[model samples]
Target: MQNVVIIGAGQGGLQAAMSLRQEGFEGAITLIGAEKGLPYQRPPLSKAYLKTGDADALSLRPASFFEKKQITLVDGTHVEAIDRAARRVMAGDRSFDYDHLILATGTRNLRPPIPGAEQALDLRTLDDALRLRNALDRPMRCAVIGGGFIGLEFAAVARALGHEVTLAEAAPRLMARAVSPETSERFLALHRDMGSDIHLGDPVCAVRADGITLKSGTEIQADLVLMAAGVVPNSELAASAGLAVDNGVVVDTRMLTEDPAISALGDCAVFPDPVTGRAVRLESVQAATDHARLIAKRLVKQVDDPYGAVPWFWSDQADCKLQIAGLAAEGDDTILRPDGAVFRFAGDRLSAVETVNDAKTHMQTRKRLAQGPVARAALEAAEFDMAQV
Candidate 1:
């Protein structure tokens, strides 16, 4: 292929462009994004950026890097439609044809349906972070809707900055969907100790101008409201173009769509898990960057190997850092180690390992998972030593 057109300019999209060049693909690459300015990391928007307000540090690549790589960056532009028959994408009056089309559209924050939800601020982009930082300059009461990573991260930072933080989650525990019950409880204690009022099993029914109303008929007064419930994949463009989309753009093990000429990656693509053969969509820098690298190899070097990188994730809250190795499904059995490492198991096999401020165990678990599924018996024989497993 002599030309490649990728939609979305988030971390995954930028990585695809860079990976293609690294793989020696001398094709014409065009990376399109709806956001303005150079692509930056989203993880830090709620962590370091909130504390330092350093936008420059979040940039994935400098302007000179793109110019040197000869990658065309079309920022502040939206792909209105894809012409499948003609193999071109239309954005207003501009049009670009591609020999291979990549859908890296990423995702957007899901705004829960509630009265006055529009009044709540968002932290999905750099612009959103800047607005939030400006609001935090003076004394303000902060109410965060959702106890997921984004919400909890922001609450930790807001509380650290001397703001009264009230975090509300519909689920019974913080990060309920991602972490084990034991891990969630650990964070609950940590956040509560930090003076953050934790409200679980009570979701915000409505976001008012002054604060939020909970499902349990409780009203919390605050000067600022943050919406970080979750994210929805940006798959509408792929679906409209007649490509199969389920949860995210459905792709094979090779990360290619039904149409071999097209491929999808990152948070927007759902592919078969190399281990379990289940369709899974992941939202992590590791998954996105790995997907890009694998796709680049396929396009440039004709590599046919399936994408099988073990998924890992991390979250920074206050002074504690939570790191997870491998993917775990809901209802996985959990075992808590004396040293505070939590291991998740699906039947007799190890699914994921959760650690707090234990980088040594986290890295070892990641390497182990990459080899293959770890049997529960093996872990038991090792006495829960991640290195032995």
Candidate 2:
């Protein structure tokens, strides 16, 4: 276990390199990523980056940090295939041997088969965000193709810039896959109040130079179209090598894949849900960084504790900062608080908590969820403060 090679230069990949150093791994480490430059945070690409075009702030660490940490970074490289028998990864003509391989390949934006969808712009990478920011320099009519966090965040920023914004969601609600209905309703109200024309249950049939046409025959006139529909995991690399891949590269509770020398993490890895036995793939800084830490500990110090870190996420739109702690399964019942906090429960077990601009409650929820499930009666009686327990 001297050499560790990580494919992908995203947050999770970089975190694995850093965590290995922190865990006292003096072995050879190589982090290969297709993206150029250092690993940066993607959350702000839709939020703050859209508003100010601040690229430097998104960097996880300075360039000097990587050199000082002795983490070999190979940027602008694509890992075409994995030679499982040879125990080496082939990036073009170059071959890198590894004692252990980590697939932090992450995910890519899902482009649906809609007419003229090819004309829609993407905001997944730094260059994409820069292109969008330059396009938004003037007064332009903007139509976002999704109602998810990224789409809504861009719409909010575009609206703030005095642009005419029309957000289209194929689903019945905004952020349909992530937050609770109550939280979604709140965010929907906030976006609408900010003068963005939000259309729900309306799928974009086509994108024209003028605007987007919905499935209901309604046409939205806009100068620019943003595609933030969703993303699919980049698990083809592992699947090609005969590894199990569900929604993502399937891993065990310890973050190890079918092969002992191989592991997966972040939005690319489908691991067991800490709360349930169900397999889950989470695209968040929390899951990526936590999984990296767990993998590093297991490899460096042989710390074999099961991966059970509490999941959390945050979205910034307008003046509202929505934060979520824990993972709630579908069909989870949500208990709404008077202060706009939504607590999602799976039967008697507490699953997740959604808070708007409430950092105190968010932190408390994460802390409490780490201690495992709490009774419904105790939570209802203990009031809003989980710390009060």
Candidate 3:
């Protein structure tokens, strides 16, 4: 049995440890994290946790599970550096050797340069969420920067809480990087219908204590400002240790880095897309957990399967639930289904399907993608639903 040392005790790192044990690998597993307390899910920090404030519900597994599984969890300790020559990791003054190392450090919210930007809050980690939650206790006009998933999610929640919410995006549409133009337009209407002042293609130039001023010189008065612009991959540790870092820690199809002794997963690692071979870093809980399981299987049971799992994502904005089954690159053609579902096609191949408030369709599309490809003619036939297709 090999000794596995996992960095970043987030969803991915924790899953890697549990998956290793589940695969019946009787080996030493150490999960190191910089965050204090237990590892928690960050997605709900902006969605459910904003309204509920349940820290217990966010945890992936309790401390007892880690102990019972013999998974050594080291919390509140930052991994200072990596000694590649000795295959050891430095956390403060302590060091731990490993037969294999998995880096699942995840990503941190990108705080762009704006005047008095520190006054703006973030919605990434648990601490950020808690601070924002506490700030929401009093009635306040809030301006949210960025139109990404987390930003939009926060905007939706804030608007529901009777806060004067203004959502500003540098891009013309919401979730520009991930979702299609059609989906972006749909969400824009939804948020606007809910009385949110949504600004597109405009970035905030300054974040004053009282309000935010956009680049166009339009001032949006608000009591709170949330900076949800985007996230930068936490790959500095891996990159510093001589691993390739392009946007994220570059890994092969097997999720192994150039060193072979080290592997990276979750939002921090850039791996080749199973279908397109294009390098991409995903920030979904599904991707993180699945990537961890893939690495675990490879390390333990010697299941050398390529990372072929289909990519899927979900975002809850207000009452609408946006679900995407696959990664439809920018150039993909989107076909609007009869039920308002959007099916994306890259040339003749099915690229992705975007559905709002349609969990069944989402699950079916994901299953179909896993079942392999369907003919373009079959999809266009209308006789074949996503399931039969």
Candidate 4:
């Protein structure tokens, strides 16, 4: 390929450009981003960024790295549309022609249609975090919508900073979609012990300037409201280009779209699960970087291997650092070990392992899962000892 054009200059998009060069591809590379400034890490936006307010530490690569790598970095430019027939992308008056197109368009925060929802702040981007951090300069009552990672992490930080926090979740448990009931209950207690009011199974019906009203008609007084319900994939660009889109842009095991010249990855692409063959979309940094490397190798070295990297994720809330080694379904069977490791089983096969403040177990679980599925019978024989298994 003479020219590779990647849309969305987030982690995946930037990694694609870097990986292309690392794989010895001597081609023109263009990385387009909607946000101004160098592409920064998003995971820290909810954690350390809120406390330290260090925007410089979040940069994935320095400005000199981009220039030295001979990669064209286009910031503050929103791609208007893709002319698939012409194999060119239009961004205002400028156009970029690509021998191969990589769509790394990530997701945006999902704002519920509640009245005054737009008034609430977000923690998705660096600018959003900066706004929230500035607001925390003075002690203020905070009402956080959503009990997921972002909301909980923010609540922990706010409460530690001596602000009154009230967190509301639509689900009955914290991080219900991602964690086991045991793990959810543990975090529930963790947040409550940190002095934040936790509301379960009660979503915010309306967001106001002063506070938020729960579905149960309970109004919590607050000076600040944060919307962290969830996120929606940025697949409109690919959908307009006539590509199949489900929850995200549909890609194969190779992360290739229907058109041979186009491919999608990261939160924007829904590819089949390496283990289950089920369509899944992940929004973690690991998935984005791994997918980018796989795509780069395929383009430069003609490596046709399918994407099978083991999925892993982490979240920092207060003194707890929760880590998950693999993807687990809601219906997966859970086995909580005495050491606080939660093992999830899909049928008889091991699906995932959840650990809090246990990096050793987390890494071991990822290595074991990457090797292949471990049988429940074997775990039972080993008395739930991950090392023995």
Candidate 1 per-residue lDDT over residues 236-341, each given as its tens digit? 9999999999999999999999988899999999999988999999999999999999999999999999999999999999989999999999899999999999
Model 2, residue pairs in steric clash: none
Each prediction's TM-score versus the true structure: 0.99, 0.98, 0.98, 0.99
Model 4 Cα lDDT, one tens digit per residue, 304-365: 99999999999999999999999999989999999899999999988999999999989988
Candidate 2 on 315-372: residue-level lDDT in tens? 9999999999998876799999898899899898888999999999999988888887
Q: Which sections of candidate 4 miss by over 4 Å?
A: none
In model 3, what are the clashing residue pairs, if there are any? none
Error of 4 at 184 (Å): 0.3
When summed lDDT is taken over every stretch of 10 residues in candidate 3, the lowest stretch is: 380-389
Candidate 1 stretches greater than 4 Å from native? none
